[model samples]
Target: MAAIAGCSGSDGGSGGSDGSSDGGDDSSSDGSSDGGGGSSYDGQELNVLTWGGYEGVSQMVEDMGASTNLKLISSDKEGFNTLQGGGASQFDVLVLDNQWAQRNAKADTIVPLRREEYPAAQEGTIIEKFNWPYQTFGFDGEQWAIAPRWGWEGMGYNDDEVELADLESEGYAAIWDGDYKAMAADAPTSVIPLVMQQIFDLDENPMAIEVSDSRLETLEETLVEMFNSVEAVHQGAAALRQAMLEGNAEIVLGVGNFELSQLAAEGFDWAKVIAPPEAGGWFWTEGLCLVNNPDLNRDLANEFINACLSPEGQRSICWDGESKGAPANTAAFDAFSEEEQKTIMMYKDKGFEAADEILSGLDQYLISPQQEQWTEIWERAKARSDL
Candidate 1:
């Protein structure tokens, strides 16, 4: 594993772009670099490879007036798979799922975060529940990532097409309910197992990749049935949204605010997103981590991350109107206008407390030993989508 340089002290107090340090020589010396053979990103480009989806950091940094050569890339693959495929040196920073912190830290793919040294990395600005290291973003008493955005995944239905009362009674069975045509993401790794876990009252954590062979046998049967009955199980969110808009699907499984909010913004007022009462819900947090790179431009990398954690950065991430989710920066909620807050359902009347209660009752995703088996099963289920 290559040794990474300590983060450059680019907190908001410094001068550069919008009070952010721009990798200048006078920047406070926070940590030491590995002095590796490769040149620093000081005069070169900074490559950022993100997992899951783009988090808007490239634009945010540029907006903050950064002059660093920024190259942002997005990957649909899980963070662990990216690191396993030798992506560590390819990118200087990774905006990834919070769950990958432990595995990546163990693999030495990410550097320990000294949040105390950075002004924008203040944990106090983050939601209280997410501030706990053991609960959200720490391993072995050290920090690895900064939690920024979070949301839940479960189900979405068009109010005009399906009765809420009927869905409440069916719970996880709503996906298989013959009355409504179903469309789901083809990835059974999270989609099918999560719903089945809810159906049989098994583990509620969607991140749990492992399952007992006997349990998987039953899960496979249940998934085959659902896949065969559905109109089509698309591979990504865009396709699933198309299916819903074209009237091919009435219910979508394994969706979250990222999709529902955009759909509503597009005038799908009848769309409603929820976790079945019986299944609770699955929650995930998006975090920013410094990749372990020998040629890392520590100053620029830290500046980019701090910019995202700043109050303004938090507000822009959630209230952008196009992309929507609960900002991990709790203070961002108050900064939003009344209408904007309501748009994301963060208002008093929207049962924000009630929604938070439901999310609290849910379990975080965890790594399970049955991960490989689940992947194989998911592939089989996908093949049977038309069956």
Candidate 2:
């Protein structure tokens, strides 16, 4: 299924006609803004690569007086592969997962962002948890990416078949219960960490990247067991949702509240997401990064980033009618109506403090240095014929 498009309306927050707070002159008919004698990137094309349905970002960039060429990608792996294959120079801005952003920063495939240049990128403008030096997207004392959207991955269960209290008490162990048929996404990044937590019986910091050789062996065994126990392994949110709706599985793993919300909207009110009590679920963020292209127009690119961080921009990027994820910019909550805020998984009636408190309890998804090794282990587990 195609990702849903963002809800329309709103000029993308306070600023000049170009969607920037720099007090620039009105954009000319040709889509070029003169920022108080600053250089106008006339006729320049801002090439952006992001997930499908993030057109709100494109609109923000276009409003900034630049022609935009937006390329939609299906997965973080696809985006990372594109950059690794020397395609970084083709786009000025790229939106990727936090871990992928970390990889690109380490590979020098993306440039560091100057926080001071953009008001929206500065300290206190966005959620404090996503600020600079946050391990997920920051490293080497540089801000490598700006996370504009975030959500947590947990088990989605049919309320009719499973008790919330039972899942919470059992935590990761709930997936191993032989009586309950389970299904999961094919995403190793989303599944492995939780598996590790289960194997280690860890109550906190389930995202530690370094895995010792002995731990790897044990993890392999556990993964094989978990895989064999599941009803089937599916790819994409659509397939997972289908399995649950068809009663092929009573529980789905590696899905977030966003998916559950989508299911509820479709009249599957019994669908619900829960972070296992013992090992809090994993949280993921979508970050916007500057591609390391020498030919890139830095000024316009920065402007685009700034615009996306605005209140209206956050609403456009984070909410689509059915699925509501938290915006990195807290001020964006103001753009949403009370009903809309209540629908947001993180925002609910309590507001930003509530969101922050919930996030604080969840584990951040981090880049595992041995990711390839983990994938190999996962594949080997999946290949085992004996249950």
Off by over 4 Å in 2: 1-42, 84-86, 203-207, 321-324, 338-353, 385-387
Query: Judged by lDDT against the true structure, how good is candidate 2?
Result: 0.65
- Which pairs of residues collide in candidate 1? 207-365, 210-370
Superposed Cα RMSD, model 1: 10.1
TM-score of each: 0.76, 0.79
Cα misplacement distance, residue 338 of candidate 2 (Å): 4.7
Q: Which stretches of candidate 1 lie over 4 Å from their true place?
A: 1-47, 51-65, 76-92, 118-123, 134-136, 203-206, 294-300, 342-355, 381-386
How do the residues 105-223 of candidate 2 rate in per-residue lDDT, one tens digit apiece?
88888999887876765657677888765667777888888877776667888888987788878876677676688887666766777777666856446456576799889888888
Best by lDDT: 2
